[model samples]
Target chain A: MSGPDPERFDAFDARLKKAREQRQEAPERGAVDRSGMGTGLQAGIDVVAGVIGGLLIGWALDRWLGTSPVLLVVFLFLGAAAGTRNAFRTLQRLMEEGDRR
Target chain B: MASPLDQFIIKPIIPIEIAGADLSFTNSALWMAISVAAIYTLVMLGTRQAALVPGRLQSVVELSYEFVASMIRDNAGREGMKYFPIIFSLFMFILFGNMLGMIPGSFTFTSHIIVTFFMAACVFVTVTVIGFMKHGLHFLTLFTPPGAPKAIWPLLVPVEILSYCVRPISLSVRLFCNMLAGLTMMKVFATFAVALGIFGFAPLLIIIALTGLKILVAFLQAYIFTVLTCVYLHDSLHLH
Candidate 1:
């Protein structure tokens, strides 16, 4: 075949350049970009889930052993403490990831 | 119209009873099998031709491979690459399960807490085992936050242990709630679409938008699940 047309090649080069520029500008389009809102939500979930999990386990234990509210109260506080710690740890990790970027 | 929640009913596909334990293959099990098969086809057949320039199928396979690979690298480092198969499989299974559930009549396995919890428990157990295996009793140090006051060890240790224990619950709940909410929202909107008759177009538009969001959520949840697994793996491998 004859050599490729310069006009077609120029158009292709421009298109490729534009695509590259777009890709660079919007590199955070995928899962890599963890927004503040997403991080906050995840942290919130971690905390809440921790507390709920602890409460359930504590209540179940109390029911089995007939300890009334003692275990429930104790575990509830422990769960909250755990939840808070989890939230803090999650936030710390997210911050470190952000700093690395 | 059927209740939106009705879609999640786990009716047995092949009812089987052994010693009074229901070991029947249910809809959830069926869909799980389907998801596995779908992923196998996509990954195995899709990348069969290791071409210089990938076709559509090969591109998808490569993209998924790189996505999980980079995720593992970023969060867990090169050492974590050893568990790539497990993480990759988890991602694809959840991704496909969520996507497949969006089909009108299909069951959403991920939406069920039982299913999600089972998967999450597996990850938690595996991670914990790996940590113990690699570090033995030193893994207990994972609970001790560095630089914390020695006096507060009593308070900090329990909290750390509780949080560690809660990982499976949180992991499972996150995926379950997201899938459940998306499916519920779609069902409620579809109901409105039917009730509105000609004016159903408004709800239809919302449903379409919701479906797009659900798709995004599906992919994001899978990524989040995998990334969190990597994070836990990192913690296990390199305790602070």
Candidate 2:
């Protein structure tokens, strides 16, 4: 049995191509609206993750060194700082992408 | 009625023990294998006939190829295509895994923190190794932000290191939480539907709506994971 007709196949291909192009253009216009909430959530997670990671590492170091509260206190501040910086960076990147678009 | 969380139970089909290790093949493993097999069949068989005028499956395959190709090009540049296979495989695996999990009674490996963390860790390690290999000790300069004063280097370095160290954690948590939330919501609604008996119409409508949302979330999470991987690749390769 013969495959699909050549002309019919070409017409279908053209329609698919058009649809794909439309999708491609749609994202550019919708990027901010689409990712607004997602970006905010990601930034929040980045900050939280940074702080928790730092706290864990610092607490472990304090336990190992027998320094008790000193290292923990220091690391807590450091972790907070790190978390803030990460949040800043994330927002910066989002802004840059928005500007680029 | 069965507990909603019972869907996630990893019951072993063929219990096996090797050298005192519990290496039994569980439901999660079975679903993972199913995902891989499905992807293989879709791509391999779908594109077997490379016709100028393609069929539906061939169009899907081609569109995915172009989608990922443009992603890499736009994010990581031409040099990044060397890692295309890894990125493409990652995207397809997660995409298929997420899509498959939407089916009732199937396991979602991506919903597990351990699995997502493992994949994130792999990406983190690979990117770090690539950075070190390409730039030698200069890669250490990644910790130092440009235009920062030398006096503040000591303060900035630790913060940068801390942020960098938490990448895998954040990446894994993002995917895990999203998937778990979607699955849990569906389960809760399903429970409501059954419990509501004759007045189950409202819960049924909500469940239907949620299924559509879950499908969108699956695609979005997969896309996000792949895009982040590309971003990491770009950062490591260019030191930006």
Candidate 3:
């Protein structure tokens, strides 16, 4: 046979994309609950962890560099900012997942 | 009355010293061994028959397989299926640990930050290695969002790195905190039930409800952990 028609291949590609999207959009069975309690707990953990992680890293760096309180204060603010970013990203991901379901 | 936190005390069953390290077999280790054995037995019994018409054990095994498989497929796409063994093992281990700990007087190893942190760190290291392997130096670009302003790259990159580095902490802390809080609350309420005597039924009722909720949390936390692993794996494989 000669080369397959280009238009036909395009049509098939579109159909395939549509099918995949549909399969993804269908709500999965036995899905874990992501709303209410789960979301709240997850966001809280992300924020708290971000802050704690930043603080520890900052404290250790300060001790090693003999910078005393300077790096500690800067990292403390950075840690809070990171924590907020983490919480925002987590919520955004959950919201996108919620939309899909 | 005993303190509610007394249940978490790790007493050595067999003390062994190797060099400077204290490598003692403790209650926590015992419970972990038990959880592993239980999981192995369930899988062995479930698959021993390998029948066309499934028995109860086989059904449970098959259901768990399907659940994890679908979760991977959904979150990570087709390429992610290659890491099924690690993800499945994690799911079963945590699920088994949580469920077994529900039994009175049993230790909950997952409640310990060290254990959960170790697991999460392993995941973080594995995913990072895979990302670097797959994309080489380009993996560093993961810090930068697509189509972002170049001027803000310095500020944004550190924040991105901070968030990235915090994954293991958040992952471990989430499971640790949940197990710790739930088990502590249960113990405290049980203490209340005993102290109240006849009115023990009030706290008893609360404990009953909390038990059900705890079971749900056990499963949900396991699922959440596995799902997040898949998401991270997907990120490594396919960047943003």
Q: TM-score of each candidate?
A: 0.89, 0.88, 0.91
Q: A9-97 in candidate 2: lDDT tens per residue? A: 89999999999999877646422144578878888887787778777888999999999888888888888787777778778866876
Candidate 1 vs candidate 3: the DockQ winner is: 1
How high a TM-score does candidate 3 get? 0.91
- Give the Å error, residue A38, model 3: 2.5
List residue ranges in candidate 3 displaced over 4 A: A1-30
Please, what are the lDDT tens digits per residue for candidate 1 over residues A4-61? Answer: 8999999999999999999878635345566677788888888898789889989999
Worst 10 residues of 1 chain B by lDDT: B215-224
The residue ranges of model 1 lying beyond 4 angstroms of the native Cα positions read: A1-37
Candidate 3 chain A: minimum summed lDDT over ten consecutive residues — where?
Answer: A26-35
TM-score per candidate for chain A alone: 0.67, 0.64, 0.68
lDDT of 1 by residue, B80-145 (tens): 999999999999999999999888899989999998999999999999999999999999999998
Model 2 lDDT, residue B16, Cα: 98
Best by lDDT: 3
* Candidates, DockQ: 0.64, 0.49, 0.55
Q: Tell me how many residue pairs clash in candidate 2.
A: 0
> Which is the better candidate, 1 or 3, if ranked by lDDT?
3
Clashes of 3: 0
Ranking by lDDT: 3, 1, 2
Q: Could you tell me which residue pairs clash in candidate 3?
A: none
Candidate 2: where is the Cα deviation over 4 Å? A1-35
Overall local distance difference test of candidate 3: 0.90
